[model samples]
Target: MRGILAGWDSLDPALRWLMRINLIALTTATLLLASAYLLGFRHTSVEIDLGVMAVSIVLMLVTPPLCRRYGAPAAIVGLTLSALIFAVGGTWATPNLSPLTALLTMVPLLVGFAYLGRRWIQVLSVVAVAGSAGVAALAEWRRTEAVSEEWWINAVVIAASLPAGVAVVVLLVRSAYARLQGQSDELVESRRRVVEVADAARRSLERDLHDGAQQRLLASSVTIERARKELRAGRHDSAAALLDQLAADNREIVTELRELARGIYPPLLTERGLVAALQSTARRSAVPVTLDVADVERTDPQVEAAAYFCILEALTNAAKHSGAAEVHVTLRGRPHLSFTVCDDGRGFDRGAVDAGGLLGMEARVAAAGGRLTLDTGPGRGTVVRGEFAP
Candidate 1:
């Protein structure tokens, strides 16, 4: 059963809906036909109705395989043509079933045009439904069948056009509801990821302060107390040497704090612009870098910051992971702020990318209303690019 319906989930909602309708109708017809002898229905011939049912089941069953092998366009064309044949053929096969088939056939007609958007196919599908309804109405005008057997056929055939329109409305509501649901789910997940990344960064900053600047400040306080004790005992040389060491320690602490702060957000980014900040980053990279940044005017601070950080992360990744000798960095100003970092490194498999590095960059870019993409493969080098909105 799973194999039979393997590709069904990939079909468009409208296509799936048409398939469900056909399945239900086929099941109902099967049951009705089973008891037709008792009801004295299908007494004219079982063979014709049986053949029609068999052909329809076969056509419907083949749709999923075609969807997998040829994709939606081919599958849609085949399914729509089958529906057209079913519509016109049912009217000729049995005037009784024509109204139901004509009404249902409009399902594909409306859905097909909305999805496929081909004018010629639209005209052909429209003609099929209208033509089937016309054929049924003409048969009603000069009918020789028993009046009891044909009580409601013509009324339904006349009303087929209205029901077709209603089906379009029904599908429109369903499509809209589904779209909203999908977007809502994505929004929730995106927010959750942003919060998670922010929490992780906060923890990292706390750890850095505790290990680097905070630890150095505590040690310096101890040294200052020792120097005071030496001065109180009138040991001038000892106190002076201790004071010099304390000054050195203080300088180291200041440098450590500034470096840590730079990791969070660069001071140069605000002072000069994105181009100057990026050049500083390129100079600091472990691998050789060829920087080519456009001297374009700055836009949104947030947009510039996102592009800056993504390039920084990409350069870090290339240095740490890809053993590349040289990296090329590019920034564009026109249309919108964008940047690319390409390295002639021995790239790793994309499937094995570090989620923390790449995902964090992606989230940061998304937060700033931009996009990030990576192009890489083993032994093929790596390229990371980001583009911001105009």
Candidate 2:
């Protein structure tokens, strides 16, 4: 069943066309059977019945595709009418068990109607019931022989079984379709959130590069130029002091650039793996951070990177905003990797923080198919937790 569904999903436009062709062929073949029965074998009114059956089959096959493409309700009406025509035509000629075949034809129609949704399903049901009743009455009127007790019981059995079978199939198909739609909706929502986070992260990086690193580099360049001019003017003491200050400023700028680059993408995550990198991050945090990592070897690189960044961002946020004295970082690397960063701070409202660093952290996590959650409120220290599957 899984393979069949997968194959159906893999089909291109041409294959869909082939499916429509096959539906037409099946309808034509059913009509041919009815014609052969009435004309070739039973020797009933041949030309009119054949023409009617052909028209009904053509309507059945042609109308569905049109309705499927254009007007769905009209297509459903076409299918229902096609079934009724077959039922009434069979009843008029055979009058023995023709209504049974007509009811049986409604099974696929019901399934299609259910798949389409409630409005169509209701329309199809009303048509099927009314059509079947009309066919049964026509069959009763057209009977040449007297109706027997056994025939009534058989008719009742056929009538009951056909609709029941159709109902079951329709309900089952409807349930399965609903489940698929729900899963599709969930996937769409997840992707939308991921896109939002990534866009915010890009904007934040642009701001950081423009406002922080760019300005620092500019200041360092100005200091070096001033030092050079002082040295050329034969002011050795002032030049030496200026040069020393320039060197110090350049070093600070370099450090800030490195830190900014790391924030963009950490090299430690790729080199040393998640555990060592997270440990280093925890150790470097401003507040006292307790680090705990278990079964580090099992962690995948992408998972490791996401976990590391989430911790770094959370710790950075804690230091900058939380006014926290202490923080804790923990990692569990079994079943699925999980990380938590908790700080003891004068916590602000999580809702009030605009999506900047936190949003970047979320993007990184989501890119690896993970989730980041922040828990903080007034007087409540923040706890940022993230989880990723392998």
Candidate 3:
């Protein structure tokens, strides 16, 4: 059942139409053969009736491919014409069987028309039921004396079968519509996530270029100018001090650039996985920090990385701006992996600091399919929490 559903879901709209048409044709042919047997074809010669059944089966089998190539409606019209020919022949030759055979013939038309929509389906269903009633009434009128057993039996079968067929076709149409809706929703969510990730990557690159490389170049130019002025004034000691300061500045630039690069894209994330990466970040932080990681083995890589960065950014902000004495980092990897960074510091209003570090952190977390929450106020400690799916 799953495999059949999967195959139906994967089919293109055009192919699905063809499949529906073919199934209708096959079912119609089966109904014709059953009607022939029920009407006692033994009264006629075996050779002649066998030839007629063979022709009907051949016509039904050949119609689907031609209909698929030309047009569905055109093909359906052709099938209806062929069934009408059979209906006329059965009514004249085997009079008692005509109503049941004609009613069965309407099944393909009703099922095929349902693909158009509810309005068309209703129109087709009404037409089919009315036409079947008209044919049964005509047959009843021909035998004016009394209702025969075969006529009553055929009438009961036609009444039960028509409604059951209609109900099954209605359910199939609803199922197809629901499946299409689900696929559309999935496509929308996938596109949204892709855009978020792309935007985050672009912003990270811009920030790194501005804060890391650009700052270093500006600092280098300043140091060179200072050294030149000191040398022109014949102050050897001052020039030497300026040169030493330039060398220290160069080292700082190199260190900061490496850190920025790693933050943008970390090799350890791909290698050691998320737990070790978070541990490494905690070890390198400036403040005295306590780290806790639980259920590390089950967490997804993307979720782990997002949680790690959220904590790293929170710790950096706490150390630099909050005047924090101690910071605690906690991570739990379960149904979802969650990270929390708490600090004992003079906390600032989260609303006031919306654009810079906090906003950037929020964007990063969101891009990773996660959320970041901040808890901070005047004179109180700050807590940063992030959660992501595994």
Candidate 4:
């Protein structure tokens, strides 16, 4: 079964549909033939109907290979034309065949419209319409008292209803395919933005290491070496002073290193939770900040990290760039973990910050399956809002 399915998948999609329809037609024809033989309708040109069914099956059986050679449009046209011929021949052969059987013509019409070119669709559709009409007219002309006066009415209903139903199905398929494509595009864009943000964060980390920790460590090493030389020269007084200076320099280097590490991933976020981490960030902000934090509640670690970083970045942007006197930070724990940071500062255009500091914040939020929105304009206060899934 798996092998068969793999083989089927190898065929063009249009050819697959054509093949499936043909198989179903063959099955139905077999059933009808058996029923006719058993019901004493053997005198109604049953051999002719059997021959038509065999020919349809043969056409269907060869369609996949033909589609591969001639393309899907030609294959669909073949199947459609075969279906029309089957309906016409069967109607002529079996007086018991219902005029409503003409409705089957719509199946191929729909297939042509959905998968074939407009020119082919137009041609096939015309043929289907003409064939259905011909079947109804022939039935009406040959009718006697044995046939109901409303046989032609059934034919009209079949002709009208099948096309409408097929049209609806075609419309629905197109709509679903379009929606899938739109989502695929969005996912691609989101992935690209995430990569850009990640690269920016790496550059920022590298810059911090070079300018802060590396420079400070170099200075501290120089001081320590100078103090060692003084001690070796037996200059106790100068050596003591140099030692104290070295201690201070080393302490400064340690402090700078701590700050750099915190910037990467703060320890406060893990040890004290998002509220304490955010409060620590607020306290360090150059601008004054007010916090409306909810009670500490355990949540997904990734979500907590995203919210904390979002608020932190907003506060940093507000203090350094917004020229704001004060900032407000709000955290909510219910429904979904969320936070908002607003600053009363000179705001900048959101679109203008494409690869700016806010991108790191946006990336963090996106990684957590959250949304980050920035509302800002020149001279207007900026609002940074982030929400996460529960």
lDDT, residue 322, model 2: 83
Tens-place lDDT per residue, model 1, 1-390, is 567766655455545665555555554554555455345443333435445555666676777776654445555555555565555545554565555556556555555553454674667576666766675774465255523355443333223323443454465457757756975886786798788888878998899999988899999999999999999999999999999999999999988888787889999999888888988888888999998866468778898788888888888888998999999998877535678899999988867755766777888898886668888889989999887644
The root-mean-square deviation over C-alpha atoms between each candidate and the true structure, in angstroms, is: 13.3, 16.6, 16.8, 17.7
Q: Where does candidate 3 stray beyond 4 Å?
A: 1-212, 218-246, 355-363
Instruction: Please give, for residues 37-59, the per-residue lDDT of candidate 4 as tens digits.
Output: 56554433455656766776666
| Model 4 lDDT at residue 313 | 78
The segments of candidate 2 whose C-alpha lies over 4 angstroms from its true place after superposition are: 1-183, 355-363
Candidate 3 lDDT score relative to the true structure:
0.61
The residue-by-residue lDDT of candidate 3 on 1-390, one tens digit each, is 233323332223533554454445435544654565567633332222334445544555554445333334434444454444444333333346554445655754554552344554565566567656655665555455323335544443334233433443455566557657865775575566556656766887898889877888898899899899999999989999989988988888888878887787677877888777777777888888898877656355666666666777788888898899899888775434678899999999766764456665666676676667888898998999886532
Candidate 1 displacement at residue 105 in angstroms: 31
| Deviation (Å) of 7 in candidate 2 | 37
Off by over 4 Å in 4: 1-183, 351-354
What would the TM-scores of all predictions be? 0.52, 0.51, 0.42, 0.53
Where in model 1 is the C-alpha error above 4 Å?
1-185, 350-354, 378-380
lDDT of 2 by residue, 1-390 (tens): 233223222222222333344344435544555545544433333333455457665765555335322333444455556556656655664466554645644543544542355666666666667766776777777665523334543343234333433443345456557756965775776577677777877888899888987887788788788878988898889989988887787788788888888777778778878777777777777888898777657456777777777788788878888899998888876435778888999888657767666766776786776778888889989888887633
Report lDDT (CA) for all predictions. 0.69, 0.63, 0.61, 0.67
TM-score of 1: 0.52
- Compare the candidates by lDDT and give the number of the best one: 1
At residue 146, give the lDDT of candidate 2: 27
In candidate 4, residue 260 scores what lDDT?
Answer: 80
* Worst window of 10 by summed lDDT in candidate 1: 153-162
Which residue pairs show collisions in model 3? none
Q: For candidate 2, what is the lDDT?
A: 0.63
Which model is ahead, 1 or 3, in terms of TM-score?
A: 1
